[model samples]
Target: MSTPSQLSTNADLRILQRNMAAALMQPLTRHDGLQSRTQVDFITPNDRLSGFQRLEIYARQYWFRLLDCLYDDYPALRVLLGEMRFHKLCRDYLAAHPSTSWTLRNLGSQLSAFITEPKARDVARVEWAQTLAFDEPQKKTLHIDDLLGADPSALRLGLQPCVIALRIDHAVDHFITAMKKTDADVRSGASQAMSQAPTRAAIIKAPRLKKEVLHLVIHRHENTLYFKRLTREAFLMLTALRDGLTLADAVELALAEADPTTDWPVQIRDWFAEWSQLGWFCKPSPQP
Candidate 1:
């Protein structure tokens, strides 16, 4: 460990390692550092594939597995592109985008942008949304009783992870909505007409369990992302509260949205009932 020569050798080795990695990354072309010493080992006459071949297997496997994860996550995008074209897309993507993510989950975070290129925008819009829908968080649900005298001071709201907030343009939103409404009609011999009007429907935030269409915050009771949609007003109220608004203030905001004439107390009661039923709020029962 104290040898200066060894230290110098290590620095040289690191430089060489970087160069070697770069060469392997690029197509079979020459690079400065990899000039005459192109490969680590030369292929012997009898040996068909060299040591580099054996080493490359690992690199190939890494790319394949990561790409496979992307495919599994973005099947809709793949379908839109078709098999051969999808393969080309993956090829072009991998070479240009190298694996920059620490986890495969993060791998496709930018895939939406990747597919949003001029040629791929149409399908990218669909695929990116799907990917986000799949990865959104799931939180523990707060039962109905938790919404009493909801004081923001000591209250902590547990939000469902699967709850997505999408602000889509009218055209894409409408296209998606129309697709959903026509699933049954499509099979029933109804003629299809297409129009660009934005409709917002929750994608499959929850994978299994009896409930599937998202309109609310998504939670995982045991295994699936179950959603309980909140009315727009209620959602806004919670948003304010979650961001540190006092219970009284949040209630004021909520009551204002309900109806100018509706009694605030009554509105709060009714809203609490729904919030509790949806398991959207959790109150800490034990006092300090």
Candidate 2:
């Protein structure tokens, strides 16, 4: 029923698909030309466009779509690296780590590891955590009443799925917050030409973030994301609980490295109440 040219086996089809995929994923030439490949085998040349040009359309679109996703995911990283550098970063990062996941949400999952600059790396890490926190599904949160009369020594607790804890050497959170505010203000000021100019200037003249050890919890509540700063001990305790340690043991481990002069008992109670209200705690699934 089929001619020889139209006939195909599984192997033939697989080779065709592989060739097309390679063409789409290959990097564009310096002048935005397609790299040398055997596109003519499968692609037909036309009067207006050659076979390679036709393939280049899809390749450029594919790459542009991916680059746009990285821009959306890592706005702060772009700001830190500047526009041109960010573009280079995206190309280099993609070359090293292509999109393997079905969803673009995981595209920048390895970006932090790829970045070499400490400041930029820290920003990338925070931005990536925010992305994850925004997308992660929320679970039933543990309220203060749920913990009443519970045995601290034996009861293990879980953190909300959206909670992401980070300890960084610089106040990158503050820097990002400032950047976001500036962006919002610039957008608002766009209506008033007089205000827009200064707002844009503020972004270029943004102050450098001071180097400090910051413990932060990025969490989402009621569909809004928040960054909550924590004391070193509280950070340790919360991370410990997230690691499946019982409350008493977690507290003990947290306090072990804390300042000796501080009244940790009162602090612990206060931290628990605050975190409970924030709905950061959840009940872990029982092990088999």
Best by lDDT: 2
For residues 1-288, what per-residue lDDT tens digits would candidate 1 score against the true structure?
Answer: 111223357776676566456545543212111123345442233367665654454344444455566555555445445565665676567667776756665565566567654324544544454444455544555775545565655555544443343222223333333334221111112333212211223333221112122223433333333334555566666665555566667766766647667565766668767656655454322334
Per model, state how many residue pairs clash.
11, 0
- How do the residues 181-268 of candidate 2 rate in per-residue lDDT, one tens digit apiece? 3221111111211211011121244447778899998888777788889998899999999988999999899988788999888998
Model 1 off-target regions past 4 Å? 1-13, 23-46, 51-56, 84-97, 100-102, 113-141, 152-156, 169-221, 226-288
lDDT of 1: 0.48
* Every candidate's lDDT: 0.48, 0.78
Off by over 4 Å in 2: 1-7, 37-40, 181-207
Query: How much does candidate 2 score in TM-score?
Result: 0.87
Worst 10-residue stretch by lDDT in candidate 1? 181-190
lDDT of 1 at 102: 63
